[model samples]
Target: MDVGDLLGGNAWSYVGGTLLVLWALVWLYRDGLQVDAVADKYVLVTGCDSGFGNLLCKNLDVRGFHVLAACLTEKGADDLRMAAGPRLKTVLLDVSSRDSVQKALEWTTKEVGEAGLWGVVNNAGRSLPMGPSEWMKVEDFHSTLDVNMNGVIAVTMSFLPLIKKARGRIVNVASVLGRVAANGGGYCISKFAVEAFSDCLRRDIHYFGINVSIIEPGFFKTAVTSLEPLEKELQRLWEQLSPEVQASYGDKYLDKYIKVQRLIMNAICDTDISKVTGCMEHALTAAHPRARYSPGWDAKLLWIPLSYMPSCVVDMGLKLVLPRPSKSV
Candidate 1:
């Protein structure tokens, strides 16, 4: 067949096949380029009190990297210390506070000294009041943004000099919501900001030999995904709403909202959080780390594609799934 004939017949199939092959080759190449001397490296992880941060600290520590695990509570720090090796040190850090971040920076500097920091995992985040945007107050948005967005920027900026000196990695834990905006409230907005910030930081810091990676994970059954706290918060928000707003939404609407939230959480949240921490590991250790990593199957197959679809289509899909308010027009 001539080139024109081939292009006219099964062209899309050929293109798909070619792209798949290229992707496989790139994956193989990436797998082959991992850094050695892991024992000599130092990796600092934030929010190691639980979830991805806690697991990642233990994982990297086992692999021989000196891990500085930062937690918000002394209990959390002690728990991590007991769970991890002696090489794994725990520091109390509240990413939302400048004083806390600065203290942690000084501690890390003292620990690593002239060797510099090899990696910093900005895994501290919170997801709360994730109902319709109209249900949330301004403070609710600020609560999530303070931890997930501003915290990331503060910690990353504080440690950039050390990471640059070591020519190291910065892995920021965002979410599938960041790409797709599937949920409402500040969680998605903060994560979206994280993606933007990470992209800009990557480009700006590449000259310093610093690699920046953003981890976009799908629904994971971490504390952040717990339905109980969300349900409680929803109840609180409902109670706090003005009489007019409450009358419009009605108790039935609130009940349906909570039910749907619980259903979605149970159905989609992956219990095996290792899928996420594993990506963080690769971002820290790989010689040619990718700019973005989507760990969960749902993230790669579902939400990422949804994120790229037309806005109207996404809106319609969401509308179909969301519970209609009593006075919805």
Candidate 2:
């Protein structure tokens, strides 16, 4: 080849290599940057019963951070307190109840004192009333929304002063479902709300030297992903439906729905929950925390990608996977 042509090709290759090296170096710098004095920093994580919340409490405790774990049950609190180090404290908190949240706030205020709260992981959430939207009543919807959406709002609003005092991080556990709708219940709706709230909160609180990170995990083997309770809830809703409604869907619909749900859960649910808690830890510890963290492979590979696709394409795919009603034209 002529010298000019060879030089031109090599020049583009050299430029590409330079750009790639710069990007990797920047990523490593951000990844390595962590906050100072982790042992003194106080971080409160909600929903520390038996899932991401529980795992995160232990993970942070091991890293020498002062961890405040909030569980809905006394047993859960006791279990966690037993497992964690002396610096890890547990509180009984039912996020849906105002009184419970208020009590927890007072306790946290006393614990953090002048040092302020470093991080707050709004992780408590429930997934139920999850079948077809028509099968659920207002009360069923309320049950999920009360804990998943309102609970986040209540906890965040109540603790803003402490968070502001420290000018720290607020890590919220949203779901891939938040970005893409694959279900028909308040679970997805609630997460979508969380995503919106976090976006608004980050903008509002950036002046206080605070940052907000959203954790959007795919299906994981947590209490939230258990099929037994979901199956029971589906049966309960089916029984409650009117005769005409039941006839329209036919007897086979419920079974087919359950089967499809089971297949999807089995296929996609990642057993290693550490994938989620790891993201949570980085969000809490990293000096330059990411705006969003999607942990599981399904999150990165499927749900997140689907969220960015065209509505018609997503709708068509959903229609293909989801079971059709007997009454459908």
Candidate 3:
């Protein structure tokens, strides 16, 4: 066939048009369908003190779902209660602490009762003491892992029975960093653990009619991404380093490290957090929720794609973007 004939809409055009139509239909069917009886369902969201968790709690309350908002502080709980509808209940939870998670679980059990918990959104996490892995101490790693990784595991285990009873959804908040490992410190490591845990949990629990979904959002403006606390934390790490170690890295390395982070965060951080919470909501309410959701343009266009690239390419790109250590050969 002549090229002009194909351009003029021949069998090739028909095939292309048909494929586009089929893609659209599949997209609509996947996103448009939602589960019924949301009013009777209960969804428990952690880290409701602020950010995506807070917004999701408000949105879910407005949608008529019984939203159990878990805040780490009394002020956060009070603030959430004031903003959300009366159907929204608040629980004080510190997911990193075993005792706190247990108490919250008991409270959640009583609140949910026989209907059980319809959804568990593990939105709590920490992202600090982030720099060169060598600059960090074991405690620094644990401090972030305690909240971001162990916290997710503890919360999921505590609520697994309840979720099984309801045969409902488990939505765990990971990050695009989980797939890409584009940063140092425990933040990416913890998220990588979340990705693995979510996958294993999904396979193990699917037989019980439960669905586990992972939310891998790119950077957003939240407490997790705040620069103030990070500045203080990184400074402390630098100061505590032994004299030889400090000399090896040079006095100005810390400045460059923080500056690089600031530049990246400023360039990529999305202020519209609803982009993430909307994916979480869909994971909760969709009749056939996706196993994973990457909820930002950066995640779709950059980080996730980088994760699939050849290791040598990713390493070379990182070497160009990331600062070299003063002690490097």
Show pairs that collide, candidate 3: none
Models 1 onward score TM values of 0.93, 0.96, 0.94
RMSD in angstroms between candidate 1 and the native structure over all alpha carbons? 2.7
Write model 2 residue lDDT over 1-329, tens digit each, in one string.
89999999999999999999999999999887988899889999999998999999999999999999999999999999999999999999999999999999999999999989999999999999898999989999899999999999999999999999998999998999999988887999999999999999999889889999999999999999899999999999999999999999988999999999999999999999999999999998899999999999999999999999999999999999988889889
Number of colliding residue pairs in each model: 0, 0, 0
What residue runs in model 1 are displaced by over 4 Å at the alpha carbon? 1-23
The residue pairs that clash in candidate 2, if any, are none
Which pairs clash inside model 1? none
Candidate 2 structure, TM-score to reference: 0.96
- Which has the better TM-score: candidate 1, or candidate 3? 3
Judging by lDDT, tell me the better candidate of 2 and 3.
Answer: 2
**Over the full model, what C-alpha lDDT does candidate 3 score relative to the true structure?**
0.94
Give the least accurate 10-residue stretch of model 3, judged by summed lDDT: 4-13
